[model samples]
Target: MTVGYVMLCHTALDRAAQVARFWAEAGCPVVIHVDARVSDKAFASFGRVLGDLANVSFSRRYRCEWGTWSLVAASLAASEQLIARHPEARHVYLASGSCLPLRPAQDLADYLAKRPDTDFIESVTTEEVGWTMGGLDIERFTLRFPFSWKRQRWIFDRYVDLQRRLKIRRRMPAGLVPHLGSQWWCLSRATLKAILEDPERPAIDRFFRRVWIPDESYFQTLVRQHSRKVESRSLTLFKFDYEGKPHIFYDDHLQLLRRSDCFVARKIWPNAERLYRSFLEPQEGVQIRAEPQPGKIDRLFSKAVERRQRGRPGLYMQSRFPRRDHENGKTSSQYSVFQGFAELFDDFPGWLTRATGVGRVHGHLFAPEGVEFAGGERLANGALTADASLRDYNPQAFLTNLIWNTRGERQCFQFGPRDHQGVDWFMATDPNAQISVISGAWSVPLFRSDLPFATVRAEAARLQRIETRYLEILRSMYVKARVRIWTMSDFIENPMEPLQAIVDEISPRAARRLTEPPQMVDLTGFGRFLQNLRNEGMKPTLMGDFPVNGDPRIAAPRGRRPYLVQ
Candidate 1:
């Protein structure tokens, strides 16, 4: 279930890098394509942050235009580079770097592994007219325009309405049926390879070159026609306002985002750093698979940062006295391991009490009220009291086959996922799933995702024992780990302001049009030229208001360099 990521981003390298790093650290190979419409300073900085990662790569920039062929071209270019770079990656996840993971990596990985043959793509046939904006599927497929529709979209749409009123129907390319859906997807590598290697791709590319919002239709149509195994769903969650653009995630959307049962969520705005960070951190009952590390002592130990952090308003968890006691004295040396365990197995029953023979506070083990097992099946009947004889309290009987893998020690004890109890141990990848996996000082729970609860639980029982043991030891080395959802103290100053203000900040003389609102011309010499070509029975493979060598109209080779962003 190894995966690769292909991110198409046009702005905010800082935000994009965080997402790239998140996926890269999760062991997925990542390929990024920055829209050539972005500023050079932005592209260069984005490269610096992401290029350092061994698993990350970049495609030559493309001046991707919305609602035009360039966007599809960029996606195909990125796919080629991505699949070539990660030949073994079973799935290639297409996303904007602004997208954030809703579940931990392992959860997504496990979900894909369970359905290894299924492709998570949202594709519906051309007959599904409701998907077309205002049911204008024909307008998107039949029209051929030289200018981008996004700019002056009203002009193109007015023409479309005029055509409908006048009963004008243009013929579509000979044998193709248009399909439309969200562009974001987790495509099977075999399917992607088929797309890249398909002999008819050039012909299909030519037909869609002029289609409005080709990004929405190009891959959807081709993959539907070419592949048989599709789930008709995308792994990324998105919410669109009436205008059809993705809404920005904010502080208030946190809980809604958590319970969405999605692996990724998108349309993250730049200033929404706090929201992004929370997704990266383990939420309650969800232990995000660890990021690669031997902690950076300098950052963790910096007194200045610590003081600053303490002054800021943030969520902090104080461990129960038993773990805190273990964290004191010589035991504190394993603080990361202890912290990892605490965050992961926050409420696993009898863990810190007179159970597992770790540290029995009172002769009787006490669990938090409503403790649950791997399948989210609860066992604890009531509150955590000093009373030794709670109605449903049992020491060893609570959980059998408990195991731990300590950081510094190598010895006899061993445990992993294949163990039947794993389903009850690491709560099936639900942020709400109540089980967790604890190895000595470290513990992790199931990451949240879209898999059915039964599947998740059953799958947990089938995971390799080594995967469990390996991850626990791997995640336990980070000291003071816990769930953190940040909020802006110097807050709520228009999120888009920073994006707009970048012009003045980075390079003032850069092209000003890329940032402008979407619009297109009704009459242009280039538009006429494209229409003339179609009238002449010419089927051009690629068409756009993009510079190919010298002139925007001149045809360019498949892998030529981009002119705008540099």
Candidate 2:
């Protein structure tokens, strides 16, 4: 029995892509239904990454107005389509774009296949028990409007406000008590087929047409009523705060995420791209741009700082040579390079020889000052260029050595470029793949403008130029490699002031789609950036460090634990 995951997505293309990518490796065919109200451009952007996959599908754009039947109706329509398209699928797990698999795909599939008789969903009556009003009520579940509420906010705002203030309680008709549970559910084919084919579905649907929030409750009520073996607890994982808002994940939650036994989680912001990359296996075709070119000692050292800081230094470490003599004019030419700096700096010759020339570090040797780099020609502007070079002096090397190895102790490199203009390369075999920039800083400049202007302005412009250059280079690289992410490294560090003009100058040329746009990942605030970005129709990613208060939820406790041998 093959179990598949069906994601009901609405205007969440990037997330859909992420979910699809995660599932692809898990061997599960995915199907997505974008609420019809989503723009064609949004669908196209999602299709660009997911279109090639035979397992994914998009529902015809159907209007899903809030507090309307359209939302529930749309979900039913999409689910039916998925069932028709993939008849062999034994079970259908309905998830939102925000959902992420918590368990390995194999485990979830195995669990589902073993439980063919049971339906995993959350459902319970709230007839006598009062539940939170707005967004998830029975009234809202059955009601469906033609357009999104926000689009008609001007007209709907007064009514919504009035409804909120009135605290009006509508009595449920006889035998139509409200039931509520998790928005996500996984059900067997038999149950889903029965629900879809029910001749009395219209009767139930008609009764809930006046309900407050039907999307969340309608499915739960119907599934519970229909399934013989329904699990009250949702198998998918999510944590909500006391206020009912879903808990947002940050870097601090990494440990918890690793420990989570569920197959997926939800509500991850778009800016969490780095976290996504870290969780996935290293793609055979994906090449990190942070490594130094082989044989280029200067570039190697320059790249070491970024690579080491991130705890993932690359090839450069193999040939690293430390500063043997701090005293002026001490010749290092005879210092054998056979052994790495670990041995050379230890004041001992562990493996030094003259035959292979592998360990010789002769500092006395000097090439002509004007000699150009090897494998590279001079640019039209008369600047020396090289794909590979052995240089004694460079800005990257100088800065890196000063910051990390000034004391001649163990040094590490950063994973990304340390200096602004330190060109990084992404090697892709194709020439026209997609490359996007996914970071923005509208809030920083808007809020911090009152401070000193020149330094802030200069810094913003400098970063923007680097970002622009990165985009340009990425475009070229994508032709060969298919680079899909262009996240802004530092977006929210701007001055508080009017930054409209500055933002306009920094924003990139609009493309056909923004699979990866400039999104602000404000590690400093309670996702203040998310609020602003979403308001502007720009999807932002949440890129904060885990354990904000140094909490170890995302990390291990400092001490060791004893084993239990009962």
Candidate 3:
């Protein structure tokens, strides 16, 4: 049995596109249903970033208001789109754009192949004990509001309360039982086809169109009434916190996620994009995030300083990477939202090479966070441009710090161009790294910004001519610092271009292995971290499946694991 994907998305197009691309790369056919309320320009932006992929398609726009029937409408539309094109698909996987698949597609499909007739969805009958938290409210199935009742605090809710006080209950249609569960599920094709084709399909659909949060009940009720072969369990994992919404997945949840047996998890946000990216990459061994312990806190710090003092430089690790604003002492965010590329710095040659300059080093920023951050409805391939800096950086000024580190004792060095008319990279090796201006041309500006600020149109395109020099300077600095395999640490969602460009420019030997991409092994080799998914009969992604990491340069150091410094 083959598998297909149906994603329900509202915002964060880049995050959505990244998830879509992950599945597309996994050899699954994907259908997306973006909310109709999204502006055409925003939807178009998603399309533009995704470009022309062979296996991906979008559903017709439908008004998808929260806690309303329109969400189910959008989901139904996506399932239709997937089934219409890929009838051979046995199961239609339903999830949100923010949802991530924990198991490999092949494994999940193989598991489903073993049981072809059963529909997998979470369901609790209205009469079931603890069906709706405190108990199922009668008004949910009886509500007849034309618009989303959640939007107006007074109108529908007050009226519904009045009706309840008067004991006016709308009776459910005979033979139709009310069932509720998560809005997302992986339905069997037979179940989907039956639900879509049932003579009562239209009747049921129209019946729930006025129900509040119909998405949670519509499919649940239909599958229960229609299918005898049904699994009362959802394939998607969720932790509905106190707010009744799935907790947002973040870096800390890596272990929990990897260990989950569920095929999918929901409520992932952009800050966690790097975690998903790492999951997709699959190279750096099992991901295990540990909270800092109180006992070893001061010891770790003193030991690090002592080691550095003794010529045995201790590694400096901080998982909570913040935006550049934090470095300048101006950030209010507890942690930086972008850490995908930063993690690369801790891997293989990244740590092995850059460790050559250990204490107090300042790297340049090409694509920064916040200003040219992974923000907006940026889908994919929305390369960072110079003009984007105008929103944050001075219009007349050029060159802002993207990244820097502590590589030397009492000495801080920064690598960036003096001006961008042309591009070159430089670093101060002494404590005088904070100099106001260069005294001479040995530190000469490679490219002097000459064109009047008025002539600038597309900042990135306008400056594309000299980006080569910018890259060259970066390569030269890496060479000068003797940092091996200088991995680009700026990009998040779109790392291929910058990664390939840097590799092709600096080290051609390592660039070839990236050609074929990563491959997945069968599910029998699944990782042991799946508790949530395993409990549900869902398997983790195929074992031995890893991100592209065969290149000797990117590979973990030959002998032993890098010392832990975090």
After superposition on all C-alphas, the RMSD of every candidate to the true structure, in Å, is: 38.7, 27.4, 27.7
The better-scoring model by lDDT among 1 and 3 is: 1
What residue runs in model 2 are displaced by over 4 Å at the alpha carbon? Answer: 127-131, 134-177, 282-566
Ranking by lDDT: 1, 3, 2
lDDT, candidate 1, at 398: 26
Whole-model Cα lDDT of every candidate shown, in order? 0.54, 0.50, 0.53
> Which regions of candidate 3 are displaced past 4 Å?
129-136, 282-566
- Candidate ordering by TM-score (highest first): 3, 1, 2
Candidate 1 Cα misplacement greater than 4 A, ranges: 154-175, 282-566
Query: What is the per-residue lDDT of model 2 for residues 1-566, given as tens digits with 9 covering 90 to 100?
Result: 56777777775578668777777656676777777777878777888888677777766556766656676776777678878888777888888787765555666677777788788877777653344644444435333333345567565656655665776555544455567777688888889888898787777777666555567677777776578798876766665543456755555555566555456667666566654655544444433222112223224333543344332221113334343222111111111111111111222122111112122222111122322221123321223232124323453343232223222221111111113233134222222112222333222442234555444444444444554555566567234433444232222232112122212222223212222222222335324433443455543332222232322122344687889999
Per-residue lDDT over 1-566 for candidate 3, one digit per residue giving the tens place of the 0 to 100 score: 48898988888878888888877777788998888888999999998877767788998888777777778888888888888898778888898878876655666777788778888888887666253542334567875656545678578666667766787666666688888877778788988988888886777777787777788788888898777688877777665543354557788777667655556777776778566775655453443233212233334434644443332212212432222212222111111111122323323223212323222222222334322222222221223343444523542122222221222222222222223222122221111122221111111111123544233222322233343344454345343322212222112123355444533433344443345211211222112222323354443221112233232123334587789888
TM-score of each: 0.49, 0.45, 0.49
Tens digits of per-residue lDDT for model 1, 1-566: 58888999887778888888888888898888998888888787877877779999888788887778887888888889988877778888999967888777777787777777778778887676464665667667765555556677787777777766887655655566777899998888888888889887787788788677888888887787667598887878776543465667776667667656677878877787678878876566865443222122223324434443342121122422223112212111111111122322333223332122232111112233333222243332222233324423432222211112122221111123322232222222112111122321211132223566455444433342434443443345432223111111111112134223422222345434233321111122333433433455542222223222232222345796778875
